[model samples]
Each structure stands twice: as structure tokens, then as C-alpha cells.
Target chain A: MLFLIEDAINGILMGSIYGLTALGLTVIFGVLKVINFAHGSLLMVSMYAAYWTVALTGWHPYLALVIVAPAMFVFGYYLQDIVIKPIFKAEQDVREPITVIIVTTGVWYILDNLTLLLFGPQYRTLQDNPLRGRMLEIGQMLISVPKLWGFAAAVLTASGLYLFFQKTRLGRAVRATSLDRQAASLMGINQYKVYNIAFGIGTATAGIAAVTLVPFYNVFPTVGVLFDIKGFIIVVLGGLGSIGGALLGGIIIGLIESVGPQFMTATWTEAIVYGLFLLVLFVKPSGLFGVRYDW
Target chain B: MTRRHYNKMAAAIVLILAFGLPLVVRSATYLHILVLLYFYAYLTTSWNLVGGFAGVLPLGHAAFVGIGAYTSTILYLQYGISPWIGMLVGGVLASFVGVLIGLPTFKMRGAYFALATLAFAEGIRVMVENIDRLGPFVLNGPRGLQIPPLKLGLGNLVFASKEPYYYIILLMLLAVLALTWVIARSKLGYYLNAGGEEPDAAMALGVNVARSKLTAMAMSSFLTALAGAFYAQFTLYIHPKSVISLDLSFEIAFIALIGGRGSIAGPVLGALLLRPVSDFSRIYFGDTLPGLHLVIFGVVLILVMIFQPRGLQEPLTRAYNRLLDRLAPGQTKELGT
Candidate 1:
């Protein structure tokens, strides 16, 4: 029972960051209809930003979030407006929508390689931080203090985004655009602004997630590739455009990743994870909680 | 001269260049680049057979390529088979695996299909890296295979220098290009083109969409695997990480796309265009900025996406034809008249 509880807790902790990493990707996909393959790289860059800020100024990792989050948000906002906008403007045949996937792939290569050039191949870590070795125990359950922050960040941001969509005008407009771009535009929504903001907020989640996660995973150029692929699986599992689905999918994947090795050898970890991705894809392409792609 | 005469002249010039340039350019390094250029041309052109003509967007082709590489290498290392024979065995293996990947995936289209294929490719990477329990023979997994240096000869397909490789890869590329030409003019090309253009319509017309796609995948897989086998022999190493990497898949796809996929010469043009850029960048700026070449390539991709997302092949051919028209407007029509 104790081991089970411990595994579940660990799974949930890992799931939080995964969920957070996926939120932006889901949001961007929701409105832009472009699968931003570069999202993982965005998170990677943000983690590095947090790392460098702290490394240079001796600031706490969490304190670096304010600088990094907004920067990432802006970067995503402009990327959609500048590069992606023109592609959308091209004729369907002349500019294949699939080209956007290629374009994001290009962006991914640029960002990943640019970082490698700047940062070299070394993994950057948060050293001498108070989050290190800090843990909370609750009756045989041990949780790292920083990980608790990760869970909190995931929960808070999720709820925050939910409420934003529920209450705010911009959020509803964003949702409306996602539901149907033409219909929403007819209702007089500035389609581009909504897309830009959706993209920005979506990308900002990576920053928040990175801040929470840097304490656990080291900052590296290729780190985003891991999360990006994981985040992609989670997004697909949750449903293409569903935010809550991403969270649910992430937790489910986390649980599997955490407890799967107990039943099998470590070699099967990826097979297990990717197998689940295929399973979900085959069984419920719409995802567990997501509605069928009506639009 | 007529268009046929122009084509013959162009062919003659191209043939002379392909064979003669190596003789003139004695630098082994230059020949090495030319060899790699043709190799990529082979892989990407084969990839375009399925990706461009069939429009399946198979992002997992690296899986087939890697399978071919490892299959041939294992056959050579473990069973004492020559790579020449092993390449054929590898091609057959990749075709089988390609069908497996295509059977379920051909039902899907676009990004979903791309994702499934990517999953299979990544899955292969994971599977190969964990073969420790397979026994005493070191397939090397992630550490990669280091083949014992073989005797330099035609039978072994191992040469002491770059000259033979240049001719071999160039011949292989010409063979693939010929294959592409035949396909373009044949019934299979029409089936693939029809299936790509309108799957439902093709099925309605009795063009077996699934079969067409499966056929393309088989050919594509076989050709790509041959390239992989070639790479393993030339590099004298086989790492799943390098051979089957996602980066290589993306590179193949981009080369095809940027060169204008679906056309016979598109992948060839793509490989030729990017090879020099990559080599130049690596030579000049690679030391100062480890990834400057890819950065430039990335920028080029973005620019291509913006300007000519339709790709450069059509535009390039048009420009070439226009130049011919301007230089000798009467010559092209004079022969027929």
C-alpha cells in the first residue's frame, strides 16, 4: 500500500509538469490549427532563460519566471503573426497546411541548434538552491518541496485558464475562434489578435512549467525534445484542442511511466508510453473527455 | 534543334560532368561531398516516391532505413554475408516492415499519419537501443557498430579511396532517377498520382487506394533501405542514433519538400542544392558556431515556406526553359520544321 501510494504521488508530481508543458501546445493548436512542433523548444529556451538569469544574477529560480514567461509569450505571439501568418495567407494548394508542420520543424531546428551554439552541450542546473533536498513527509509519503510547487503551478494555472475561458471576454472569443474561425470572425472577433493572444498565453505556460520543473530536470538544449514528444502524446491523448484533456492525458502517462517499470524492465518504458499513445489513438481518437472534432 | 535535341545535348553535358568532374576534381574531400550528395539524392528521391506522389507524409521512413542498415550489417557481421547480397536481403526486410507500418497508417492521412509513422520510428530507436540481452554479439545498440576493415575490392564494395564511391552512388542515383522517370510515365505513377490527388475518387474509379499506397511504401522503403545499407558501408559504422534518428527523417522530408516533391528531379535538385550549402557552412562557420549551417538552412526553410511553398523545382525548370527560349528561340523549333 505504501509503495503504491508513493508511486502514485511520484506519478502525479511528474504529471503536473507534463500537463503544464502540454497546455500551451493544446491552446496553440486550438486556435491556429497549426501543430507547433516548436513548443517543446520554447519550453527549453525558457528553462535556459531561467537558468541563466539565476546563474548570472544569483536570483531564485522561481523569481526568474516573471522575466522568462513574458519573453516566451511574446516570442510565441510574434512567431504566429510574423512567420505563420504569411503561410496561412497562401492558397491551400500553393501553400500546403502541412507546410506549417515543416515550418515549425524549421523553427524547432533553429531554436534547438541556436541554443546548443550558445550554451554548448553542458546541462545547466540550479545549484545551492533551497529547493534542493527540501521535502515534506506525510505519513510515509515523501514529496519534494519544489515538486509540490510544480503540482501547485499545474493546478493553479489549469484552474486559472479554465476561469479565464469561462469568464473573460478575450478568453471566450479565443474559445469561439477555436470552435469556428469563420463563425467567430463573422461575430466580429479580430481573428488575428485572438490567435496571437492564444498563442502567447499558450507559450507562456511553458515558462511557468519550466520554472517549476528546472529544480528537477536540468536545462539542456535537447531537453525540450523529450518533453515536446511527451507533450505531443499527451495532447493527442487528451484530444487535439482540449486543455483539460492534456492534463488528464499527462497524469495518465505519468502514472504509466512511473509504475510501469515495476511490472517490466526499464527497456520497455518507451514502448509502453508509445504503445499507450497508439492505443489511445486507435480507441478514442477524440480523446477521453474531448468532443469529436465537429468543427 | 528540337526539344529532343536540347534534351540529348543536356544529357550529354550532364553525363560528361557526372563522369568527368570527378577526374578533374582530384581532391578526395570534394569527391566525398559529391558522393554524400548522391546518397542523399537517392534517399530523398525514394522518399518522394511515397511522400510527394502518394501524399502519405511518412515521417517514420528512418525506421525502414535503419532497419535496412542494421539488417545488412548484422547479416555481414554474424552470418559472414557480403554487403552486396546483404543489401538485397535488407531491402526485402524493409519492404516487409514498410507494409506493416503502412497497413494501418495508409487509412489515415496528413499529420495523423505522420504522427503514427513518427511513433513507429521512435519506437524502433528505443527497441534497437535495448538489445543488450540479445547475447554475446555486439550489434552495439546506441554505442553503434564498428565493422572490421575489409579488403579493398569491387566484390567487397569497400574501396581505399573516394573515386569508386562517387561513381557507384552516382550510378545508383541515375538508376533511381531512371526508375522515377519510368514510374512517372507508367501506370503505377498514374495510380499514385490519382490516389494522391483524390483518394475517394480513385477508389470510386477502381484504383485500389490502399494497394497503390502500399506499393509506393514498399518501393520507397526498399530504396531508402538501400541508401542506409550504402551509408553503413561507406561510413563503416552503424549507429541507430545516427541512421534512424528523427533528425535524419526531418532532413529527408525537408530536402524533398524544398526541392519540390513529386517530380522526378525534385529530390535530386534538393540534395544537390542543400549539399553544397551544408558543406560550405560546415567548412567555414562550423568551428566558430557549431550549428551555423543548420541555422542558415532553417532560415532558408522559413524563407522557402514564405516565398515558394510550392517548392523551387517548377520555378527552376520554368526559368531554365525561359533562358533557352531567350538564347535560341528558333533552334528548339527548327528541327521539327
Candidate 2:
């Protein structure tokens, strides 16, 4: 019973991080209707940004988040405008999801290779501070302080986002555009501006997730690929465009990963998750929280 | 009738060139390159069936290849079975696994399908690395499985020189090419094309959308597995990292994309072009400028997607047709005027 409880706690913590990572992907998909395959690479880039800031300026890793997150936001806005917008604006039926996928995949390929070229594939750990070594003891089980902080940060960020989306005018405009771009445009919402804002916010979330995760996870070029897959799976499981679904899906997958290894080998954990994904997909083609669209 | 006659003549020329070229280029190195080209072309052609024709975009083909390689090598090492029989067993097992994966995930389109395939490949790689016990011949995990070159015989299919492997792979390539060509021209091909172009329209038109996609998946998996068997035999080694890595899957997909998808000749063209470039890069730049070739290749990929998404074959075909028009002016006029 104690073991199960510990697993559950770990799963929730892991799930919170997964949720945070997936928030940006889901948001982008919601507004732009494009799956950013490069989202993982962006996370990787942000993690490095945070890593370098801490190394050079002697700033606290958390403090570096303020800079890295906003920087990523601006970068993402421009990236979408330059690379993605042109593709979408092309004369052909270029807005097909497959075309978006190919474009993002190309971005992923370029960025991943760039990271390898720059960083040289060596795994770098954030410098050990008091926060790094500390752990919280509960009964016989120990929980790392970094993971605890990650969970708290995720909850706080998500709550802030929820409040902003509900209250702010820009958020409402973003939501309107997501629902119906043409209708939103008719109602005086600048679709391009909304896209820029949404892309910025989405990438910012990824940057924040990177900063939060860096304390525990080692930074590497390929590190994002694993997290990216997990994030995408969470987004799908939760239902596309459903933030709440993402949260729930992340927790479920986290628990599965945490407890699955106990029953079988850890190697089979991924297979188990994929197997479950297939099962869910077969049963609910629209995803756990996804609404069916005419398309 | 004239076109049919011309096609038959072209087919005859190709067959003669395929079988008889080995006699002229008896150099072991050239033959080795030919074998490699044939193997990759065959593999990529198989990949194009599902990824190109059906538009499923399986990013985990290397997993199927790994399955085929592991099955044959393990059987050969343990049960003392010849690879001739072992390869068949491997191909069947891989196809079965492919069916299992395809049945559930084929329901989803685009990114979801791609993600699922990637996850499957990673899962297999992890499993292969962690299997601790399998008797005296423990798969050396990350280091990979190494086997001795078997005696050359009809039953073994193992060769002392690259000459025999060249012919074997050539035949395999021709067979795969012929098979893909048939599929491309058949009703099933039409169904696949329709499903890929517009799934809802195809479904409305009485196409069994799911069945068509699954057929492509099964065929692709089978051919990939066969190629994997050949790869294992040729290299005399099979490692999880080498066979099941994401890099291998990416390479296969890259070849298909770079050559052109949805065309019978695309994979063959892609494999022939890119393999030599890669080999050349390895020889010249590997020591002094490691990873440079891959960096350039990545840049090329980006440029290709941005500029010519249809791949190198489209422009080449147009140019070739223009040249033909110029060379045979009277012939073109006879057909049109």
C-alpha cells in the first residue's frame, strides 16, 4: 500500500511536468491547427538557454526562467510568421495538417542537428545547489525537492493561464480565433495578431517547462525527443485543444510509466504506453476529450 | 499496343543489365556498393509502399527490420537453422507484429500515426537493449549481436564474395520494383491513392479505407523484413542500436522523400543517389570533418522541403521528357499531329 502511494505521488509529479510540457503543444495545435514537431527541439533549446544563463551569470535556475521564457515567446512568434505563415498562405491547399507536419518535422530536423553541432552531445547537469541536494521525506519514501518545485510551478502556471484565458481580452480574442478564424476576423479580431500571441504563449510555456525540468533532468540534444513524445501522447490522450484533458492525460501516462516497470521491465514501459494509446485510439478515435469536427 | 511493346523491351533491357552487370564489374568493392544500393533501394521501395503510397508515414520501419534480423540471427545461433528458412520465419513474424500495430493505429491520421510509430520504434529498441537472459548467446545489448560468416551454399545464401550477394539483392530489388509497379497500376493501388488523397471521398466511393491502408502496411513490413534478413546475412551482425535506432528509420524515410514518394522509380532513384553520397562522405570527411556530411544532408533536406517538395525526380522527369521531345521530333509529331 505504501509502495503504491509513493508510486502515485511520483506519477502525479511526473504528470504535472508532462502537463506543463504539453500545454504549449496543445495551445499551438488549438490555435494554429498545426502540430509543432519542433516543439521538443524548442524545449531542448530553452533548457540550454537556461543552463547557459545559470552557468554564466550565476543566477538561480528559477530566476533564469524570467528571461528564457520571454525570449522563447518572441522567437516563436517570429518563427511562425516567417516559416509557418508563408506555408499556410501558399496558394495550394497548403493548410493541410500533413503539410504542417512536414514543415514542423523539417524544423525539428534542423534544430536537433544544430543543437548537436553546437553542444557536442555531452550531457550537462545543472550545478548542484542546496535545492539540488535537498529531498522531502514522507514516511519511508523520499521525494526530490526539484520535482516538488516543478509540480508547484506547473500548478501555479496552469492556474495563471486559466485565469488569464477567462478574464483577459487578448485571451478571449485568442479563444475566438481558435474556435472560428473567419468569424473572429469578421468580429474585428486580427487573426494574424492572435496567431502571434498564441504562438508566443505556447513557446513560452515550453520554455517555462524547460527551466522547471532542468534541476532534475540532464540537458542534452536528444533529451527533448523523449519528452516531446510524452508530451504529444499526453496531448492526444487528453483530447486535442482540451487543456483539462492534457492535465488528466499527463497524470495517467505518468502513473503508467511509474508503476508499469514494477510489473514488467522498465524497457517495456514504453511499449505498454503505446499499447494503451492504440487501445484508447481504437475505442475513442476523437481522443479522451476531443470533440469531433466536420473535417 | 505500341506502349506495351516499348515497356516489354525496356523490361527486357533492365533484366539483362541486372543479371549480366556482375560479370563486367567483378571488382569486390564495386560489387559491395552495388549490393548496398540494392539493399537500400529494396528497403526504401518497401517503405514507399506504406509511407508514400498509403500516406501512413511509418517512422518505425527500423523496428520491423530489427525484428526480422533478431529472429533470423537468434534462430540461426540457437536452433542451427539455415538463414534461408530463418529469413522466412523472420519476415512472417515481423508482418504479424506490423498487423498488430497497424490494426489499432491506422484509425488515426497525420501526426498521431507518426508519433505512435516513433514510440513503437523506441519501445522496441529499449526492450532489445534490456533483455538480460537468452541462454549462451546473450544479445550483447547496446554492443549488438555478432555472428560469423556462414558457409556459402544455395541453402545458406551466404557468400564468400560480394558477387553472389549482388545477384541476390538485384533479384530482390527487381522483384520488389515489379511488385510495387503492379500495385501502383492495380485497383488496390487506386484505392490506396484515393485513401491518401482524400479518405472521406474514398470511403464514400466504396473503398475499404482501413483494409487498403493495412494492405500497404503489411506489404511494406514484409518487404522490409526480407531486406533486414539480407542485411543481417551480409553484415554478419545485428545490433539494436544499428538496426532499430531512430536514425535508421530516418535514413529510410529520407531516402524515400528525397527520391520522391508515390512513384515506382522514386525509392530506387533515391537510394542510388544518396547512398553513394553518404558513402563518399564517410570515406572523405569522416576522419577530418566528422558529422559534416550529415550537417550538409540536413541542410539539403530543409532546402528540398522548402523549395522542391515533390523531390528531385519531378524536375528530372520533366527535363528528360523535354530532351526526348527535342531528340525525337518526328516521333512526337506522329503521336500528337
Candidate 3:
């Protein structure tokens, strides 16, 4: 029973991390209608950013989030403006999506290699926080405090985003565009501006998540690929374009990963998660919360 | 401009290159590079059946390749089954697995299909790493499998020299090219192209879009698996990391894209150009900078996408046609029908 509890706690913690990663991907997909294959790379970049900030400035890793988040947001906004806008402006055909995919994949490769160039493929961890060693004990179960903090932060961020989308004009513009870009344009909302904001916010979320999770996971170039895959799974599972679905999907995948290893080997954990994804896809092609789009 | 004229010219050129090149370049290093080039070209061309022609964009093709390598090597080592026969079994198995993945995922649109394929590929890699026991057989976890030499022969498909491997891969490439050409002109190709252009319209036209994609996937998987078997025989070692890595899948996709997807000539050109760059990079710069070659390669890929997304082949063709016009200005009486 204790073991099960521990696994559940561990699973929830990991799920929080997955949720944070998926949040950025889901936002980008929702607003831009382009899957940013480079989102993971951005997360990787942010992790390095946080690592370097701590290494150079001697700031607390958590405090470095303030610096990295806005920087990532600006970087993401300009990146979309410069790289992604041309593809979107192109005539829609069989090749448009392919062009976007290739461009972003190119960016992914560049960022990955750049990380290798900058960091020399060595693993870096932040040693500033004593919380890295702290854990919370509840009923014979031990849970790391960093994870609890991560979960709290993820919930706060998700809630903040929910409120923003529900209440703010910009948020409504984002929603309107996601629902129908042409319709939103007809409403006098600048679709391109909304895309810029959405992309910025999306990348910023990844940056925030990176800083939060860096204390626990080591920073590396390839680290983003694994998280990116997991984020993709979450985005799909939660039903693309559904923020609420991303949270639910993250928790479910977390539980599966946590409990799966007990029944099978940990290495097979990913397979089982993917098997579940395939199962969900087979049962509901639209995903748990996906609405069928006419396009 | 007739099909017959083009075929004759192509056949004559291929024959000349095949028969004459071996005589001219007797160096073992060049032969080794040729063998590697042919191997990758065969794999990339096979990948084009699904990714290029059908437009499925499988980012996890390396999973099938890994499966083929592991299956053939394991069969050869444990049961003493000749690799020639083992390769067939492995190819069939990979095809079956491809069909399984395709049946469910093919129902979705482009992005979803790509994501599903990527997940499936990564899942296989993870599973291979964790599988502890299979009756009396063990996968050796992450360490991989190694096969001993079993004498060179047609039955064994093992080669004693780089020359034999080179010939074998050349034959494989020719076979794949011919097969791709046939498929490109068939009714199935029509369905694939239609689905790739517009899935909903294809469905409205009474084409089983999912089924067509699955067929292309199965064919591609089988060919990739066969190549994997050939690879294992040549290298005499197989590892999940080596065979099923995301890098391998990306390389396959990159080659197809760079050469020009949806063209028979694309994968060939892509592999021919890119593989040498990769090999040369590894040979020279790899030891000094670790990942510098990849960084440069990434930059080149970016530049290619930004400037010439149609790939090098289209621009080259355009330039060549312009050159022909320049050289034979009076003879060019309306270049095309």
C-alpha cells in the first residue's frame, strides 16, 4: 500500500512536469495551428539559460525564472514572425504544411546542435537550492518538495491561463482565432498579432517549466526530445486545442507511467503509454476533448 | 521526349556506370563509401514509398529497421537460420507491424498521423530497452546483438569483402528504384497521390485513403526491414541505439525531403549527396569537435528549407533545362507539350 502510494505521488509529480511541457505545445498548436517541433528545443534552451544564469550571476534557480520567461517569450514571438510567418503566408497546398514542418525541424536540429556546441554535451545541474534535498512525508510516503512546488506552480499557471483566456480581451482574441482564423479576422482582431502573442506565451510557459524542473532533472541538449515526445502525447491525448484536456491528460499519463513500471519494466513504460495513446486514438479519433474541424 | 527514349538512355547510362565504375575505381575506401551510399539510398528510397508518395511522414522508420536487424541477427545466431531466409522473415514481420500501426493511425490527418508514428517508433525503442526475457531468448537489454561470420555465399548473404557488399546494395537500390517506379505509375499510386493531395477529397472519390496509406507503409516497412537485415549482415552488430535512434529516422526523412519528396529521383539524390557529407564529416571533423559536423549539417538543412524548399533536384532540373536552351537555342521548338 505504501509502495502504491509512493508510486502515485511520484506519478503525479512527473505528471505535473508533463503538464507544464504540454501547456506550451498546446498553446502553440491552438493559436498558430502549427506544431512547433522546436518547442522542446526551446525548453532545452531555457534550461540552459537557467543553468547559465545561476552559474554566472549566482542567482537562485527559481528566481532566474523571472529573467528566462520574458526572454523566451520575446524570442518565440520574433521567431514566429521571422521564420513561421512566411510559411503561413504561402499559398495553401500539399506543400505548405511540409514547409512548416521542415523549417521547424531544421530549427530543432539547429538548437540541439547549438546546445551541444555551447554546453559541450556535458550534463549540468543547479546546486543553489537546499530544497533539492528536501522531501515531504505523508503517511509513510515520501514525496520530494520540489515536485510539490512544481505541482503547485503548474496549477497556478494553468489557473492563471484559464482566467486569462476566460476574461481578458487578448485571451478572447486568442480563442476566437483558434476557433476560426477567418472569423476572428472578420471580427477586426488581428490574427497575426494574436499568433505572435500566443506563440510568445507558449514558449514562455516552456521556459517557466524548464526552470522549475531543472532542480530535479539534469540539463542536456537531448533532454528536450524526450519531453517533447511526452508533450506531444499529452496534447494528442487531451484532445488538441483543449487546455483543460492537457491538464487531465498529463495526470493520466503520469499515473500510467508511475503504475506501469510495477507491472512491467520501467523501460517498457513508454511503450505502454504509447499503447494507451494508440488505444485512445482507435476508440476516439478526435481524442478526449477534440472537436472536429472542417479544415 | 518519349518514355522509350528516356528509358533507353537511362538504362544505358546505368549499365555503363555499373559495369565501368568498378574497373576505374579499384580503391577499397571508395568501395566502402559506395556500399554505405547504396545502403542508405536503398533505405531512403524505400522510405519514400510511404513518406514521399503516400505523404504519411513516418518519423520512426528506424524502428522497422531496428526490428529487421535484431530479428535477422537473433535468428542467425540462435537457430542457425540462413540470413537470406531470416531477412525475409524479418521483412514480413516488420510489414505486419507497420500494418498494425497504420490501421489505427491512418484514420487521422497529417499532423496526427505523424505524431502517432513518432510515438510508435519511440515506444518500440523503449520496449526494446526493457524487454528482459522471451522464453529462452533475451534481448540483452540495451547492449545489443552480435552475429559471427557464417561463410560468404548467396544463401548466407554474408560478404567477405566490401566489393561484394557494394554489389549487393547496388542491386538492392536498383530493385527499390524499379519497384518505386512501378508503384508510382500504378492505380495504387493514383490513390496515394490523391490522398496525399487531399484526404477528404480522396475519400469522396471512393478511395480507401486509410487502406492505401497502410499499403504504402507495409511496402516501405518491408523494404526498410530488408535493408536492415543487409546492414546487420554487413556490420555484424545490431543495437537498438544504432538502429532505432531518432537520428536515423530524421536522416531518412531529411534525405527524402532534401532530394525532393514525391519523386523517385529524390531519395536517391538526397542519399547520394547527404550521406557522403555525413560520412566525411564523421571521418574528419567528428574527432575534433564532437558535434560540429551535425551543427554545420543543420545549418545547411535550414538554408535549404528557407531558400529552396522544392529541393535541389527541381532547381537543378530548371537550370539544366535553361542550359539546354542556351546551347541549342534554334533546336528548342517549344520545350514541352
Best by lDDT: 1
Docking class of 2: acceptable
lDDT of 3 by residue, B157-189 (tens): 777767778778888999999999999989999
Alpha-carbon deviation at B74 in model 3, angstroms: 2.1
Q: Candidate 2: misplaced stretches above 4 Å?
A: A1-4, A91-96, A138-141, A182-193, A261-264, A289-295, B1-34, B132-143, B287-291, B330-337
Clashing pairs in 3: none
Model 3 chain A: weakest 10-residue lDDT segment is: A90-99
Per-residue CA lDDT of model 3 for A167-217, tens digit only, reads: 998999999988778888999998778888999999999998988888777
Per-residue CA lDDT of candidate 1, range A95-202, in tens? 126678888888988999999898887887888887876878988888778977988899898889889988999889998987777788899998778878988898
Query: Per-residue lDDT for A1-295 in model 2, tens only?
Result: 7887888888888888888888889888888777788888889888999889887888887898989999999988997887766666552343345655666766777777677767777899887744676678988987778878888877887787777777999889988987888789899998877888888888999899999888778998888888788887888788876777777788888888888877887767776777677666567756787756322
Model 2: how far residue A231 lies from native, Å:
1.6
lDDT of 2 by residue, B207-322 (tens): 99889888888888988988888888888888888899887887888788778888888778888788888777877767655555555556666566666776778887777556
Report the lDDT tens digits of candidate 1 across residue range B284-309: 88788787777777888888878987
